[model samples]
Target: MSSIKNILYFQAGLGVLANMFLLLFYIFIILGHRTKPTDLISCQLTFVHIIMVLTGGDILFTDLFELLNIENDFRCKTIFYISRVMRGLSICTTCLLSVFQAVTISPSTSLLAKFKQKLKKYKVYVFLCIWSFNLSFSTNRIFYVGGFTNVSETNHMRVTKSCSLLPMNYIIRGLIFTISTSRDVFLVGVMLTTSAYMVITMFRYQRQCKYLYSISHLREPPEKRATQTILLLVSFFVIMYWLDFIISFTSDMLWMYDPVILTFQKFMMYAYPTITPLVQITSDNRIIIMLKNLKANHHQGLF
Candidate 1:
């Protein structure tokens, strides 16, 4: 257990570091070249990563400070409430990224193209709405999450591993379950649909160009290339998301009873958050351009 906990903490620290670096990179880009609507979404996404990785189970760093016992209802409520808020925010942000990219890549002749033209100017408003909805949606958790302080015969207050939760009345419990399921289903569906649309658009563009230019090789534009990279990252997120869901769904029936599976599940859940920054930086055209220029300058100096 000590070994597992140690590893978790270590990975969490690394994830936090990665998120910080990505956040800085996003800031650099936001202030520099990539000021499009898509970049705005990217910046928002980066902020989500920084906040969630710092505070969420993705780092497990916060676990060290989780000393709430049965008597600390306020502590329990606030901690879990914050966690839920951040997690939900991350989900919304990622879905927004997918939608933004899809809109950005739509052809000028397409119906959605008008919105794409205006999206850049109004992206801040969209971001504000996203933040508002997620924060409001998550406020209910404050009432649902509770911790207990066990006062023993020795008059010692001890913290238990599991805190008490709200009474699962049919209406409240059903709504929570339905809401969580709907959120996941809706977000993932949008991401997948948009990503597929992007892929198809690329195929069609290449096909048309091939016939028009009699060219065997079709080069992807930087926009398409970057969007594809983002799609790949979204694919990675999707995979990890489902794995975590499956493990969580079966945890009590299977995984939770086994330390190995539980540890693996925890790692799986955190893997995307930990690796996401690296993926983003590598996928970012601005970062890639800067690296290429640096290498060229180094080579020229040598000559």
Candidate 2:
């Protein structure tokens, strides 16, 4: 238990710091008028990850609620609601990122190429719609979650030390479950489809590149590298998302959470968000170049 807690603490802290740094970098680019089409989605995703980490009470220690004298019901409701909304946004943004990248690298004569301009033009509206839908969809959480008052009540599933899910009507619960599951399935389907399309497209593009240039002269384009990174990020998200979903579904169905199992679930849930920023930083040439320039300036000044 102690070792698990320590790992959670380390993961949480590292995730928060990495995400914050990435978020600021995106903001700087936007403010400096050097924003790429993908920057908006990346910025939103990074912000969502930051909130996801903070609301992960298990990771950061929910004891702060007691120290801060927050009302138990309000605290539970706020934390659960925000966490759910951010989780929804995380998937939505990731899916959008994948789709946009797919269109980005499509051949000029291909069907998907037509949407590139429109997607860029309407992306803000798309983001607004996504946010509005998720915010409304997750509102039910405000009513169904509260401070854990009765462990003896078998219907209440304790999610955190202070928060538990209140039992709803069977029909309502089933309805919500079906709807949420369907939404997730649709998004995951889109992600996988885009991923497959990207893979095929990259393979063909590489073949063409090979024909055009000698092996020694061939170099990867920035766009291709970005696509590869998004592919990797999406693949990681899908794996982590399903693992967490299965654990949560089982626990919800049984209306019981084993401490170890719950901890494991939280680990799976946090894994993608924790690793996302690191993947972006390492794969993004812009960030790497900026870092190198800053290091050079520092060294020159010190000398």
Candidate 3:
């Protein structure tokens, strides 16, 4: 189990590094001076990517210290606190992304559509709320996660840093978990529901287009490209997240020590953020055009 956890840390480290580079590229290259909807999403996602990178780095360092049997109390506590905060932020940001995308694609008839007008204007406020919510929820861990002097004999001594959850801590942890889990369920439900609506809407539009085309008319106004992009994102989330959830739940139930399961869980968790920039770049024409222009200029200078 310890070795398995170490392997997970290594994989997460690599994923975080990739995400960090991608985040920088998106901020400096892809989204330069753009105030578009997709650009805003990219910026938010990059912030999450930075948080994940920091969390992954802390996890890697913690594992390394454990491997070397370092017994520093303050270092252990700091790592524990930082890791908890970062992990909480990652999960919260993912839920935020899902909700934001769903609201972005909602039709004028949908209740969430009203927020579209306000989204751009109050984007900073919304983000500040998200940060505050996560920070407040995770603050309890600071008091609970002190380094322990000895590990229980029953469970394997994975790391000497041995921080045990206090009995009272469980209540707070449960509350945080419940809130976070509810948020995840809500976001996933919204994504699934919105995607289904989008598919149905697209189908209806296609039928309308076909009817017009039968009379030698053009196709239906080029179909909303943003809708298609949101659908793709929701699909990716459902597939990756469902698999991770299942593997994690099964592992916990079976008390399994399989490294493969750990690997898959780590991969699913980190891979989404790391590849998000590529997904956005491919799906958004504006970003692609910008990249092309930059490349053209670079080539022109070379010549």
Candidate 4:
């Protein structure tokens, strides 16, 4: 069982490393070339990805120490707090990204069209808001975590090192869970609705073009590529998130000690990040073109 747990930890570590590399490539190679200023979604996503990578690295280290029976209280507390914050940030970033894409793809005739221009101007502010919101919730984890301590009343357990929460603190935990869950649901709904609307609009546009009958009159709509990209992103987010949610819900019911539950949770959390890069590599033509251009440039420089 311990060996199995170690294998799971290693797999999670690999996933985090893969995500970190892909995110770095996107930032420095892809986004770096854009003439326009970086937007809220881009900046926030990059920061969140970096945090996830670092937090996962810490968790990997902690797991190794546990296997070796090494008790480092400070390291354990730092790991616990950082990992919780990173996981929370991951969910928050995903929610924000979904909403941003949905609004970006909304029809000009729709009420959300006003947001399009504002996003161009207020991108930095939006990112700041996301950071602030996550930071507020994350501070609670720092206080609640503590080092592992054994009490005579109960068997020895590895407690986090830091200020511990009392029974009264359950209220705060409940509030955090409620707020986070509601935010996720709202974002998911927006993504689904926006994607569906885009699909219907595309079909209507195609039908109209077919009826026009003049080849010269037929042109692909300006939003066609953008809509396709957003739809792909939404689909990927929903599938990965649902799997993670299922594993998490089951783990809570079965308890983390259950081998099956622990295995599934580790896979769900770590493996989900790997799918993002694979999706981008397969679907994002812009990224492919950028990579090809870079390679060509390298070869020219060598000559």
lDDT of 2 at 222: 88
RMSD (CA, angstroms), candidate 4: 4.9
Tens-digit lDDT track of model 3 for 1-303: 678667656666655665565566556744466444555555666666656644443355666667887875656666656655565555555555555655665667888899877877787787788778766766765665456554454332212234443334446646755776677677678667767766776677677677666735653232366667666766776787678667745653454435455555555666665566556656667657777999999999999
- Across residues 97-164, which tens digit of lDDT does each residue of candidate 2 receive? 99999999999999999999999999999999999999999998799888876767566888887788
Quick one: ranking by lDDT, best first? 2, 1, 3, 4
Q: Which prediction has more favorable TM-score, 1 or 4?
A: 1
TM-score of 1: 0.81
- Per-residue lDDT of 1-303 in model 4, one digit per residue for the tens? 668657666766556565565566656654566522223354455456555644553356565666887655655666666666666666666655655665666667888778878876776686667667766766765554555444333332222222122232447756866776787777678667767866876787677678777757766553566457556766876887787667655543333334465455555555545555555455555667877999999999999
Candidate 2 lands at a TM-score of 0.96
Instruction: Specify the highest-lDDT model's number.
Output: 2
> Best TM-score goes to which candidate?
2
lDDT tens digits by residue: candidate 1, 126-165: 7888788888988876675555544332322221233345
Candidates sorted by TM-score, descending order? 2, 1, 4, 3
lDDT of 3: 0.61
- Clashing pairs for predicted structure model 2, backbone only: none
**Any idea how many clashes model 4 has?**
7
Clashes per candidate, residues 3 or more apart or on different chains: 6, 0, 0, 7
lDDT of 3 at 202: 67
CA RMSD, predictions in order = 4.6, 1.4, 4.9, 4.9
Over all chains combined, what TM-score does candidate 4 have? 0.72
Poorest 10 consecutive residues of model 3 by lDDT?
153-162
